[model samples]
Target: MLATGHADLVSVFLGSGTLTVAGQSDVDRKATRFDPARTTVNVTDAALRPAPGSPAYDFLGVPAGTPIHVIPQTFQPGVLWAGWNTEAIPRGALAGDSVDITLNQARGPGLVEVYLTGLDGPERVWSSRNPGPRTLRTAVPTHAHANWAFTAPGVYELEFVASATAASGAPLVSAPVRYVIVVGPLAAAPTRTTLDVAETVGGLRLTGRVSGGPAHLDGGVPTGWMEFHRHYADRDDVVDHVAVDGGSAVLPVPDEPDALGYTARFVPAFHDLVAPSESPTVANPRAPPGAIVVGVRDRYTAGDTITATALVTPAQPDHTISWWTRKGSTTTPRGTTGVLTITATTDLDGAELGYDLIDTKGNAVASARAVPLRVSPAPPPTSTSPTTGPTVGPSTTTTSGPGAPPTTTTEPCVATEVTRTVRPGEVEVVTDGHFDYGPVIEGGTLTARVKDDRQGTPTWRDPSGYVFHLTDTARTTPPAGSGYDFLGSGPVWTIPLTQRPGIPWIGWNTQHPSVLGAVTGDVTMTLESVNGPGKLAVYGQDPFGGVGDRYFGTVEGFPRSTAIPAGRSGVHVHGVWAFTAPGSYSVTFAFTTTANGRPLTTKSTLAFHIGPGDPAAARPASTVVDQVGRTPSGQECALGTRGLADTGASGDVLFGLIVAATLLIPLGLLLTNVATLAAARRRR
Candidate 1:
């Protein structure tokens, strides 16, 4: 057994069985470990491509809404790869775990480069390059796309690439992809326009024009449907729509309110060639009111009061109406009320009265026609006379008519004559009094009265150089060398004179009491012309009332020569007759001249009174004569006075001689001294 084949056989059989089983199991394990399935490296296609006709992909004239697909044709297992990648990666890795995309224009010529920027923020994703490629990276997957823009409008070939890293730590990239991008040309926008508004008679005219558009285009003015608006304070109203003519339109203003205050606006028609526009607002104007009427009278009398009235319709509360009158150089305010009363004075005889209407602030609205005024003259007073007689007997007269009762009236006193007995060369004192002639009107008669006082001495010098002296006591003879004759005097004392507008004539004193109430003399006056170029005449009317006579005295009549030589002087005897009537008496003196065989005459008068000299006595009760003709009444009188007195040489002659002697003595002494001086010189 020890070296024998039994142990060997048993051991060998067991070992051999065990070895066979172990070998089979070992084979099976090795087969399971070495299986044929395993992971490999692969990638998706990525590049930049153009959408030819899509609207979204339309760059200028390119197709729109097309996808950009970049396929890497040159992509091999170990070469450069380019495309867009939309996968996430770990932080701070090659693509920062975000979409990684790039564009390259290195192989493209004469093409606009592509650029990409952040859509939401200002991040430069990719820059445009003419001969290079630009890249973009993100750390996380995002839906935000970059803003892709082109530098110019043209076709472009861009190289694109996308990159990522594998889970097994191997680098992966897309192939360099060529992208064909088609760009198109650009277009322009429409232009702007304007409108205007103006005023016209019927309505407001709207005008407008279009500018800055295509030169040859007919869209210069808005041509389609348009609207007009009238804007009020409360609301805006659409007036109407109308056709525009050469860039303008018109709309009538509505006749609703009397005063329409509104603004007008024009809405231009909308078209593709012009922009929308409206006009500036324009306003309306104001109008005026109505007219007035005035009323007045036509005729008036001096000192009469008249009224004028103004009538106005639709009266304004603050308006004022005034009446006025304009005479020669004066403007007088009649009244401020509508109705005015004016007192007509003599100055306003032909004045014009007018009226004016004014507003509250003194703006004149209207003026009335001026009316002319007519005024008549004033009237005169009544006249009557008194009776006078002697105390012994009643001076009465009886009148009997056919159908009247017997009537008796007292008459004036008569006079008797008595001569004064006087010794030769005896001077007698005679008392003569004064008379007054009252105020005189330019064209009226004169009246007189007896002045109870002494009269002032009068020195009368006629036009031809004749002088007379009459005093209170006596009348003086004409001076020794004077060209006058001595005229007589009588009991009648003073005579007052005045001038009135009538025929040119004079009245001389005619009648007187010869011997101081003893008797009466004839009422006459003697006129002597000493020297004159004219003929002098004495006119007298007797107290019994008749036509007077013109008397021309001769030189042989001594104190009564009427027709004197051309260069000489004369005098007239005035008082010698008794006055029988108690009324006004007039004596006239006339001077007549002849030139070229034509008679030219001038005259003056002396009017006197015999009784009470009242102004009413001069005014006639019946018909009287005036400048025009004989009128039925007399004018109102304005009376005045002039007086005559007697101035004589009673005591003045001696005093005058003494003055002459004194002056001559001194003159003689001066002459003697002069002669003595001449003699002394001769002797030397």
Candidate 2:
């Protein structure tokens, strides 16, 4: 039996979602092994780390359906998977059960099926891309001539063949295929798996592999899908989350769901997509046989409206959703912490809570997910008064109107993702060496702050720098600047036009720039040169507005025709004015190419600002008359009196002096007078 035996048992491993099958064939009858030079599989390059056709091939034991994931290297007919290799199963056969399946040298698309008859049902089966087109479905398959399967009793059989029967409208055909024994379960259960998670910008991605028991979640189970209403209440009311497309599932976490204090259980069975009047069979009463502990590690205060989200990417659409609350049997079977608000605010004191998230399609129960949330009291009021809290503040503690609950339109705080703003002078400019500018562009520097809302900076060159700055509410005027050619005498120069279509204009001998850059194209270079004593003036193509900076010109010479694209927005006009009453001035001739039958405008504002040595003589007589003025200082008023005559000859005054002197001299002789007076008294 051992000598006659051709098929045998091998190693077995577990996988989460898909399967693979590979083979080779030969036309030579004597060759023992199939030649890959002629054989074509869905893949080309072998396995990663271990190259194909080497000792690494046998050591790694490459199974079918594993994705060949490598960068740059081409993997034709992309299957989108990242890995390439599958696990194994075994069958009982005498000794040499090593049977090698034969495949063709060229690659062909086909269908694959795998089945284990006894213990349960088929393990996995799959097909290629959409069916090829027959003038109808370009996405449909073109060839379906082969079919394959794997069955090795206690061992597994893997088949890979292009079948003719797998066509959409085609009939089925018979072929020799094998099936593995399903009667006996594995001697030891596969190890359990765990999930590791982290928070990201908008969501979180959970990834990990199974450990003790292989990680498997089947939404295609025929029966026995759990529907949990409430544990310790009615098992019929409970329902499990479904896996719609493939093994991977997606769930959009609601922004307003309660957070913290929750657990999750994943029931491994199939359930209905539509709501059913009757409940399906429950494979495991405690569906999801596995448990994940969850709780809120973050908290918010009362009146705190929070927004949390989880972005899920599914192999396909149509996943399920369910919600949970805290109060429940088994404690672990709890749902979201309803005591906490969707925008949870703490009561008086700060506390932490969690929300129980449930997926309701296949067998996702309350025990499937956990969340951590913090319930913090609103920031304490600086005023310690009991009624000073935010909840009782002016914008809060409002009454509901007409059977409606009050709405909250405010949130606590979050970081804004705005780019920092630079000043206007930061506009990009040419630098000597080092790179300097906003990080948006590399190796470039800015000289002025940009108008950030997107208006680009205007450019200018010498001799044509008729730059425009807003003069008032409606007009723009020029200041002392560089856009002018040397003119022996004329009025201040205005912008020039290369061409002005629809309107005839005069041409001056020196008007056309002798050395303006090569004509951009066939252009009508408009020259606004004053003649017969006037200084600056001419007609242009600009209509209803000033010529913009995009100076347009044509290469064709005069009497030549050029196709003017279209538009009047660019500079294509000419103007002139005398400087008051000038001695010398300039004449600017702007260039413009035909624009929509008008003129194309380039900012090359060629102008003649030069004037005579004294332009004061150029002022109009009326302007000079307006300057007439009176003297700056007013006449002063004088106050004076006629001189008075001196009374030097006052006789009364001289006589009085003479008499007093005589009297005083006698008085000085008063002692003599007193002696005389005493003698006169004695005589009396």
Candidate 3:
């Protein structure tokens, strides 16, 4: 989403070192960069007027004295002042201290011209009026405006590509960025459409959704027809036109083994001033039928922890994963996750462990895949048989096999292989899922868990086993703004406000069932601490896609608190989650809500593995651990504590406590240890 409005001067600017260009909007005396594609620059009908009678203006080809939509070089109050600038390109950053902005393409209702009207007459920098040069050279550290004259009124896409040679002799070229300009009256509400593909029983199902438009347009449910395009090695072919219903359209296509890719274009039905939008091309890869590949051991020792994982072919995170065990005709539910950890016992020797994969719409994709277990009794301890009555001496039991000395067998402490390591393309991560209180206390108390809504039936995931992977797709330079200055000059990894392939789409929600009911008033979320290689920042954007809220930033300060309204339905929000450097980061967030005149709070550490790294190896700096009895309630979390202390407990015992803590961490009362427990109690 981009910020929309008619500003004095929204310049097409480029970053010198990074070479990423953006629209710099100077609105309300503040400068901010917005995604030009999503931004709507409106040239009101009032901008329409007679062209200058000066002979020099004839170069515009609009015919002098004829009426046209012209945004003058000088500031216009009600009109949009659109122009290009190189002010962002610092000195000595480029080889020639300049860059060339080229007009790759222009499509609209009529001719377009960008020129400077000075003493030299009308100097044409770029014009669709003439079939001549389309490139304009501009020096670094330069700021200039030009007269923008449009022949007709409608939507116009000005494709701009900037290229220059870096100081290091590297060629710097930016991808063609289209600037969407709306000339004259608001004919259409700008819209953004997204396309997604999923494997179906027939072949492939292509789904497209038309979203985003000016809220004032009263553009009710967008009625549209989605044009599906299939790409070949040489050309793209229009496959079909499916009418969009309820803002979305779905087309079931037979698997094309020879097709290169697929894309969809949304053309809004006439009468609706919704702009047309296109989706990125989706690559076609030969994939087999969806099936769950269960990973487990054929045999296990009794009194052991069994860790089993299921990998679904053509991985779909939206699919519901259910682990089950069967002994005879009855099947018991084990868990719901890619990884299932359970204790092994002699009673479960003949039981079969398996899983079922269900689609998002409550449909079974695959089921009944299982493997029987063979659990044997654990080895008994060795004992010494004393001959006759032993004197007043303590004897050690020494058992020898053959001529070798006796060896003692010790059980493993920690179950190190429980959680599965998720990497890019392995699993679908709802990066922005709500770290919220569950609807009801399934265990003993209200705790916070990751509400995984990828599938129809949302599943609660243990934070310890859940990891948000940030792929290289999120690598980008921070735009110019005090809100983003904390990211520094280097390229940072960002989990964007919108979903990007491979990278997790991170955000938070206060949509828990208890939000409006039990959680009265607003929910206070605080960034307790961030432990990682570099600083982390969380921010949101306004309606126009400009920075809105700077909720929490490590570089700015620590323990910053923000309040989110928990209205009738609660709020679902997604923001830009940026990491200064690539590494594992544990961000702790505390959520407090008032229920029935009583205050309840829960804290969870969000584990983010930015860039390349084994997500499994990225452990939360602080973990919730059981603080009490031998048998953990498994629904508790440490309150008022940042980390768990090593209490000289065995690794196995600690691991169990960690698992137990995760099970009920969302709505349970947890304690790091006796000390932290006392501290929490005192605070209460």
Top of the candidates by lDDT: 3
Q: Can you write out model 1's per-residue Cα lDDT over 1-684, one digit (the tens) per residue?
A: 010000000000011111100000001001011110110101112223343342322332333433333212111111112112121122233322332345443222122323221111122334443222244442221111122343233333344454445434555555444433322321112433344555666655544443432222233344443455543322345667656566555556543222223322334332322344443333333212332222233566677777655544345567888778888888888788867777767788888887777887898877655667776655466673211111000011111111232222222111111123222122111112121111111111111111111111111111111011112212122223222221222222222111101111122221111111111222122231223222222222211111123234332233352332111101111211222233444433443433223343433333333333342233222211111111123211111011001111111111100000000111111100000001010100
How close is every model to the real structure, measured as TM-score?
A: 0.15, 0.15, 0.32
> Measured by TM-score, how close is model 3 to the native structure?
0.32
How much lDDT does each candidate structure score? 0.28, 0.20, 0.55
- Kindly provide the TM-score of model 1 when superposed on the true structure, using C-alpha atoms: 0.15
TM-score winner, 2 or 3: 3
Error at 645, model 3, angstroms: 35
Q: Identify the runs in model 2 with alpha carbons over 4 angstroms from their true place.
A: 1-302, 305-343, 346-350, 354-372, 375-458, 462-684
| Candidate 3 Cα errors over 4 Å, as ranges | 1-444, 479-483, 542-546, 557-559, 620-684
* lDDT, residue 314, model 2: 20
- Order the candidates by TM-score, highest first — what do you get? 3, 2, 1
